[model samples]
Target: MAFRRDPKTPAMTTDLPQHVFRLRVRYDECDPMGLVHHSNYLRYFEIGRTEFLRSSGGRYREVEEAGLYVVVVHIDCRYRASARYDDEIDIVTRIAKITAAKIIHEYEIRRGDEVLVQATVTLAVIDKTGRLQRVPEALLT
Candidate 1:
């Protein structure tokens, strides 16, 4: 899907369209060591994706209502650093590529200027019967 800018929102221009979702690491999302749990980074990526879609004037619910579902087929996450509880971080998400039935997204979890984690995720579209389906053309733009 192409990123659409909202006129009222402040924008950042980049080579690849991206959305930055910022949040603080909550206590419940952290481990006993006060560091964010590894699993929580995936959740952050999901939030980033959701916000990215919303900001681009799209919604997952709308896709589902159209009888199409996007399911994650692959994910590759690399952790470079640890984030402590209460740390404010930004999850940068971009659409890396799109195919007939698959969309690839790249993400970076950054605490200020330091990238704590990077990931790539692939999602495939499917119909209600769970059969693979090509992504709708309307959703591409």
Candidate 2:
């Protein structure tokens, strides 16, 4: 599935590809309040994105081997509810947009039918020397 920016609105529109990753909240991921730590959400997003790419036939190791690295340039996450340890959650990752130099992803972390979090992440491709580069063709397709 290909995603394109809806010119009129500031949103991407298309039948975007999505990958769902399920995980149980770990005890260590929770804070004293028994809720998952805020920072852990970022790690969850990272894992979801990595698996999403791999499921699509791309690997971060392969990209790095080609002297390219994908880095998170920006991220926006909104916490809608709290997740406690031992809860089974599903992180749904979707490709929102893919440009020459960047790829944007949208995510939803849900417990059953309830959404716990929503996030958008922008990733940029760079060379070993930290110079901007176009996203690899293998990843875009």
Candidate 3:
């Protein structure tokens, strides 16, 4: 299926205002129908989110080891197209909002000019006890 260009923005443009990460759709990620399974899209989003934090000088493991955790409190995604095995996709992540104890990220998954999925995720920072805590100061800068 031909992918659609999101009217809101061009897909996979180099000049996007936020971090862009590339990912490949593995053969095993596809279902018997030869299309990526719906659940795998969330994994793609998680990869993007993890890379975003890594690019920002933080990794999930480090954050967790530091006695803090980021739990996804809410997430929503809109699928625009199907990605097949071996397709190279780009995931663009942007910080939509940041607060003392929560962060909101927006994502666009694309293949060249075609957007396959778009999503917004909200995560909360908490300690091991699950009480909300402020995001680390270093990460906010």
What do the candidate models score in CA lDDT, each in turn? 0.87, 0.89, 0.80
Give the better candidate number (1 or 2) by TM-score: 2
The alpha-carbon deviation from the true structure for residue 136 of candidate 3, after best TM-score superposition, in angstroms, is 1.3
Stretches off by above 4 angstroms in model 1 are: 1-15
| Candidate 2 displacement at residue 112 in angstroms | 0.5
The lDDT ranking, best first, is 2, 1, 3
**Best model number under lDDT:** 2
Tens digits of per-residue lDDT for model 1, 1-141: 344444554331234678999999999999999999999999998999899988878889999999999999999999999999999999999987666688788999999999999999999999999999987754566
Residue-level lDDT of model 2, residues 1-141, one tens digit each, is 455656786444557789999999999999998899999999999999999988877789988999999999999999999999999999999988777788899999999999999999999999999999988877765
Better of 1 and 3 by TM-score: 1
Candidate 3, run of 10 with poorest lDDT: 8-17
lDDT for model 2, please.
0.89
Residue 104, model 2: lDDT of 92
Q: What's model 2's TM-score?
A: 0.90
lDDT of 3 by residue, 52-100 (tens): 7788676788778899988999989999999999999998988776666
Model 1 lDDT, full chain set: 0.87
TM-scores, all models, native as reference? 0.88, 0.90, 0.84
